[model samples]
Target: MSAPPPADSPRLDLLRFLERVQLQDLQRTRDWIAAEEKHAVLEAARRPAPPPPEWLIEYGIGTGRPAARVHAGSCWDTRRR
Candidate 1:
């Protein structure tokens, strides 16, 4: 019987070409993702942190009484105490 044709057929060549094109597209997507991640990190780093919250010093009901308690400016119990 006759042997089969060689492996280097036109179909195989077309498949190889398609594979290369897909791989290039995948690599480009990955590169875009990496660049966006880097940009996010830089933007976060450049942003300034918020200032510290205000502090409230509650004093005892006396002429020279010490501080009753220390609370933040936005504490709910500050008005009650």
Candidate 2:
């Protein structure tokens, strides 16, 4: 096997420079990600909620059973399975 390069070698210096450049790029990417997340949160807050469904189907107590009752969306007496 060949001996390793010295600590002060030009190749090592170039690698260190590349590492610093990549680190700066990584930090910039993280900043961009944070900004995008903040923008998405703000957009979601500004957006209005969707309207409730016009119809509701109440299922039976057991699995694979047919719907027990079909009521209007505004019905308040709906029971949980």
Candidate 3:
């Protein structure tokens, strides 16, 4: 009887090495892209500074304390003491 074909034949596995090399290269490129995205995000975060105290998003969006200025003996009327 004729022997079956060999599984390790060059024609059958010709692309194995090339596929492995391509996969490694693809993984390296993916890692580089991820690192680049992280670096870009960090750079963007650092470039912008916090808003100033006077920088209001909305002038009358929420309730604010009364405009009455502080006066002497005013704390006695308050229940916190």
Q: Who wins the TM-score comparison?
A: 2
Q: Model 1: how far is 51 from its true place, Å? A: 3.2
Better of 2 and 3 by TM-score: 2
* Candidates 1 and 3, the one with greater lDDT: 1
TM-score of each: 0.56, 0.81, 0.50
Off by over 4 Å in 3: 1-6, 49-81
Top of the candidates by lDDT: 2
Candidate 1 vs candidate 2, TM-score winner: 2
lDDT of 3 by residue, 1-81 (tens): 988658997865877788988999999999999999999999999897855343222223237844333324423332221
lDDT of 2 by residue, 18-77 (tens): 999999999999999999999999999999998877878988877797888888878886
Better of 1 and 2 by lDDT: 2
Clashing pairs in 1: none
Query: Which parts of model 2 are misplaced by more than 4 Å?
Result: 61-65, 77-81
Residue 10 alpha-carbon offset, candidate 2, angstroms? 0.5
For model 1, how does the per-residue alpha-carbon lDDT over 12-81 read when each residue is reduced to its tens digit? 7898899999999999999999999999999999999977569878889878979999998778777754
Q: How accurate is candidate 2 locally (lDDT)?
A: 0.90
| TM-score attained by model 1 | 0.56
Which 10 residues in a row give candidate 1 its minimum summed lDDT?
Answer: 72-81
**Cand. 1 Cα-lDDT:** 0.88
For model 2, state the Cα shift of residue 75 in Å.
2.1
